[model samples]
Target: MIGARLDAVSEIAESMQTHRTSHASVLEMEGADVTSSQTEIHHIIVSVLSTIGRSPDIQRGLTRIFHRKATAAEFIAVIQAILIAAKQLQQLCIIEDKSTNQQRETLHSVLLRKLISIASSSTVINGAAKLLSALNKEAADRQDLHNLFIISDGKFPEVAEGTRRVELANEKLDSLIVVHRKQLRIHKLEYTSVAGITHLIELPLNTKVPPDWVKVNSTKKAIRYHSPEVLVALDELALANEQLTVVCQATWNSFLTGFGGYFAEFQAVVQALASLDCLNSLAILSRNKNYVRPLFVEDDEAVQIHICSGRHPVLEAVLQDNFVPNDTDLHAEREYCQIVTGPNMGGKSCYIRQVALIALMAQVGSFVPAISAKLHVLDGIYTRMGASDSIQQGRSTFLEELSEASDILKKCSANSLVILDELGRGTSTHDGVAIAYATLQYLLEHKKCMVLFVSHYPEIVSIKNKFPGSVGPYHVSYLTSQRDVNGDFKSNEKMDHISSEDITYLYKLAPGVSGRSFGFKVAQLAQLPVACIQRAIEIAAKLEAAVCNYTEQQIRRSCSLSHRQDGCKNEPTEDVLESDSLSSGRVEGLDDISELYRELFLNLNFGFLEEHGDDRRLQFLMQARNLAAQLIKLWSSGKSTTRDLWVGHTSWFEL
Candidate 1:
C-alpha cells in the first residue's frame, strides 16, 4: 500500500510544473513575501499539501462512526477537515498556475482539473452542505467550534422542554427572592450563598426570623437562614439543569448519527489529501537536492544496476560539498559481483551502502542522489554488515555472521541486491578466508545476484580468476606521502608500512586490489600508544617472515623427499636446487641468533630512545651496528650452533 502510494506520488512529482523552479529561488521568494497575505495563503496550501497531509480526526472518526460510537464534535471535526482539504486543493490549483510557464500551461490545466475534480467531489460538497445546514451559522463562523452545541432543538422536544423548565425555574426563584426582600423590609437584604448553598437570607444579628426558616450559619454581625420555599425552588433548578444536560447529550448524538451514511466518502477525501501531501513532499525533495528521477527497466529485462556519480544521501547532507561521489555498474550478463577492498575508513562501506540506498530510494519512487541512475527493479536487498552478538540467544559473533550468510544463501535470488561487508571476520584468518571464499563462490555461481562484497582479506579478490568477467575487483583510492610531518622517511621494505600520518584518503573507488588494509594506520589514527603501535608493527613483520620461512622449509623438505624417492637419478628443479644450496650454507651458530636478538631488544626502552639526547642515541645505535657486523662475520664462516660467540661479542653491551 505504501509503495503504491509512493509510486503515484513519484509520478506526480515527475510530471509537476514545479520541477523547473529552483528551490533556492522559492526560498528567497518565500522570505521576501513574508508580509503578504496572499503569499501566506500560498504557504498554507503548500504546508497542507506537504507537511499536514494526514488527519487523525478523519481516520479515528471513520472508525468510531463504523462502530456507531462517534460524537457530534468528532463528526464536525472530520467534516471540517475534509472541507479544509478541498479549500487547500483549490488554493494549490491557483498557486501552482502563478509559477507555471506558458509551454506547460496545458499540463498545468490538466493538473488543476484533477484538483478541481477532488474539490468538487459530491461527497465532500454534500457533506459540507449538510454540516453547514445542521450547525448554527453564527457558531459555524467561529474559529474554534469543538465545544459549540447550539443546534436547533425543534426536532428534539426533550431538550426544548428541559430548556423551558430551567428558564421557568430561574424566573420562579427570582420572584421568591423579590417577595422575601419586600417582607423583610430591608432593600439591602439579599441571598448569602456559601459553598454548595444558595438563596440563604441574611439579617442583622438582633433581628427575628420566621420559625419555618432554617438557620444556616451565623457571624458576629449577621444571621443567615434558608427559606423552605427557596429550598424547594433550588431542588427544582438542579433537576432542570440535570435534565437539560442529558437531553442535550442525546441531541448531539442524534446529530452525529446523521453523518454515518457518508463515512466512506469522507475517508476517501482524507486519503486523497494524504497522497497529495506525499507527492508535494517528493517534489520538494527533488527540487531542493537537485536529484534526478531514476529510470527503472522492466522486470523481464536483464538484471542491472548502473549508477553514475552516486552519493550517499544522508552522508552528503552532513558533509555537504565535501562528499565524494562514485559510480556503480553491475550487470548479470557481465560483472555482477564486486570485491571491494581498502583501508579502514576509506569509504568502502559507505560506497556499498550508497548503492543500496539509491536502489531502495529509486524503487520507492523518489529521486536518487546521483548524476543519473538506471536499473532493473530489484526483488530484494539483503545486507550483512557490522559485528554484533546476542548473549541471551547463545550466539557468538562468528555464529551470527555465518547464520546471516546462510540465510542470504537460502533466500537471495538472481534479481536481489546483496551487500556483504567483511564477512567471516570474527573467526581465524585461514577459516575466515575459506568461509568468505566459499560464500562468494556460492553467490556468484548459484544465486548469481548483484553483489557488493567488502572484505579486509586480499585473498578474497582471487575469486575473480575463477569467475572471469563475472567478478570485478575494486578499492577505495588513496594517496601516501614518502615522509611524515617530522620529515622522517617512511619504511619502504613493506607494502603496508605507511603510517596514518602519511596517508590521505581520496574516498573514491578505483579498479584493482589493495594489498593491505593498513589497520595499523587506523590504530595510529585512533591515537593508540606509540610503543604499542611500534610493537604491533614489529610483531606483524615477524609473523610475515616466519610464514615465508615455513613455506620455504616445506618446499625444501618435499623436494628432498621427491629426489630420494626418484633415486637421485634426475636433476632437481631450479627452486629445489636453490633451496638445497641455501640450506647447505646455513650457519649452525645462527640457530641461537633469534634468542640473542630477543634478549637484547625485547624489553628495550622505546621511550628512552625517543626522549634521550642525540649523543646518547648515537652511542646506542653504534653498539647495535657493531653487534650486526660481528653476526655478519660469523655467518660468513660456517660454524656449528653455539651461544659462546654471540654472548662473548655482546658481553660489553648492557641489556
Candidate 2:
C-alpha cells in the first residue's frame, strides 16, 4: 500500500514544473529526489500498520468502552493504550520541509487538550471530551450492571483482563467444587481447567466413595474418577462466562465508534510533536554555534544587507576561532557595487562567499554566522563565481561564464545580490580586461544592485573612479614584510621555501584595491624550476614597468587640464624637482587654508616615500607641492581668490 502511495506521489512530482519561487507544497522538495532509505521507511510503516489491523489482542479492547466495569484509572489506562497503538507518524522527509508554524501551533493546542483529558477527572477537554462523554454515559447506564460480574484480582490485567460472571448457576458450581474437595477422601481433588470438570485423583479403596463416580483413568497405585455432578457445574460456568463476554465486546465496540470522531486530532498532535523536535534541535545548534538571529527589514524598506563581522559559515565550522570575520554593508545607494581584489590565497573568495551565504541563510529564516545582521527580502541571489562548465554538453569555461553572466544581467534587479569572481578570466588579458571593465560599467549604470565582483585584474578598479559614490574598491590584506623562522633562510637567498614573505596570508579584508596576485611567488612555492621562475620574474618586471610608465604619462597629460582650469597666471611648472623639494622653506603670502592643505599633503607624501621606498611617488609629491604654491601665488596675486581657486579645481578631488 505504501509503495502504491509512493508511486502516485512520484508521478505527480515528476509532472510538476519547478519554479524558483515555488513553495513545493509543505516543503516536499518533491522533485529533489529523496533517498531510497526514505522510501523503505514508508514500506515499513505500511507493514506495521497492517500488523496492527490484524492483531486480535486489541480487537475486543478497542471495541469496548470503559463502563462502570472499570474505574477512572483503568479508563485513562485504556485510552492511553489506544493512543499508543492508534497513532502513526506523519511523513517527514527533511528538516526544512516540516509543517508551517501556524499548523504546528494549532496541533500543539490539540495535544494540550488531550493531555488535559488524561489528567483531569472531568471529561471536558473539547474534542477529547466528546469520546469520554460518550463512554461516561454508557458507564453510568452500566453502574447497576457492575454487580453482574466481578474481576478476580479487582484490577485490570497486564495482558488480558477477563470478566467473571456471578450467575447463581456459576455460584452453585463453585460451591460444588468445595463440597467435592471435602467429600472425596480421595488423595487429591483437582479441577481439570481445560475440561472444566472436578476430578478425584488416587481415591483410596477403603474410603467410602460414591459408586456413581465414573472412572476416568487408572494407574497401578492410583485411580482417577470424574463426578457427574461436577460436569453439570462446569457447563453452567461456561454459559455464564460466555454471556458476560458478549456484553464486554458490545461496550468495546461502542468506544471505538466514538473514538473515530477525534482520530484526526491525535494524528495532528503527532505532526506537532515532530515539528517541536525540529525546533529543539535548532535551539541546540544555535546555542553551540553562537548564531544570532537575523533581522529582516520591512517590505516597504529599501533592499539592504548590513552584516557586522559575518564569517563564512562553512569555514567557521571547520576552522573555528581561527576564521577571521569581516563586515559586509550593501545598499542600493553608496555601497551598491564593490570591486574586491587581493593577492593569491588572501581569502577574497571566502569573504564574498560569506556575504552570499549569510544572505541566503537570512532568506531561509536561519540564523546567520554574524554578530548581527539586518537584511531586506531579496528576490534572488545570483552567483557567477566559479567556472562550472559542461564539456559533455560542448561548453567551454568561457562559454559557461558567459552563460551564467548573461542570465544574471537579464534577470537580476536592484533587489538581487550578484556575486562574480574572475569574470572573463578564460580569455586573453587585453580582451578580458575590456570585457570585465564593460561589465562592471553596465552593472554600475543599469543594475544598480549589490554586487561583489572579485578579480585579479587591477584595471577593473577604474569603475570606482567613474562611480565613486556607489562603486568601491576592497582587498583582503596581507603582511608583506618578511619574517624569519628561527633566523633561517638567509635574506639574500632566493630558493623556493615556506618563507613568511612568500606565503603569509592575513585573510583580512580592507578597503582599496589589492596588490599583485603574487602568481610567480605562488609558483615558486609550488616547486617550479628555479631558472624558469627567474626568467618569469624578469619578464614580469619589464611588463609591469611598461604599464606603469604608460599610466604615468596619461596622468601627466591629464594634470595640464587641471593646471589650465585652476586660474594660475603663469604656466604651471613642467615638473617637480624629485630631490628634497620639501626642504625648501614655506612660501609667504599663503593663507591658512593653503598652508594647512600643504602640510597634510607633505605628511602623507613623506609617509608613503619612507614605507614604499619609491622615489617616483616622492617626485609626484614634489609636483603636488609646486601646484599648491602656484595656487597660493595666484590667490595672492589677485588672479583669483583662494575660494574660487579651490572651487574651480579641475582635479577629481574637489571638496
Best by TM-score: 1
Q: Pick the candidate with the highest lDDT.
A: 1
Question: What lDDT tens digits, residue by residue, belong to model 2 across residues 458-505?
Answer: 767756767877987888887554446675534523323322454468
List TM-score per model, in order.
Answer: 0.71, 0.48
Could you give me the TM-score of model 2 versus the true structure? Answer: 0.48
**Model 1 scores what on Cα lDDT?**
0.69
> lDDT of each prediction vs. the true structure?
0.69, 0.58
Query: How well does candidate 1 match the true structure in TM-score terms?
Result: 0.71
* Alpha-carbon RMSD to native, per candidate: 12.8, 20.3
- Please identify model 1 stretches exceeding 4 Å from their true place: 1-44, 49-81, 91-122, 125-148, 153-156, 185-192, 206-208, 250-263, 484-501, 547-655
Off by over 4 Å in 2: 1-277, 482-500, 545-655
Q: Which pairs of residues clash in candidate 2, taking residues 3 or more apart in a chain or in different chains?
A: 63-252, 63-253, 64-251, 64-252, 64-253, 65-251, 65-252
Q: Report the C-alpha lDDT of model 1 over 237-277, residue by residue, as the tens digit.
A: 99988888787777767766766677667666666665555
lDDT of 1 at 403: 95
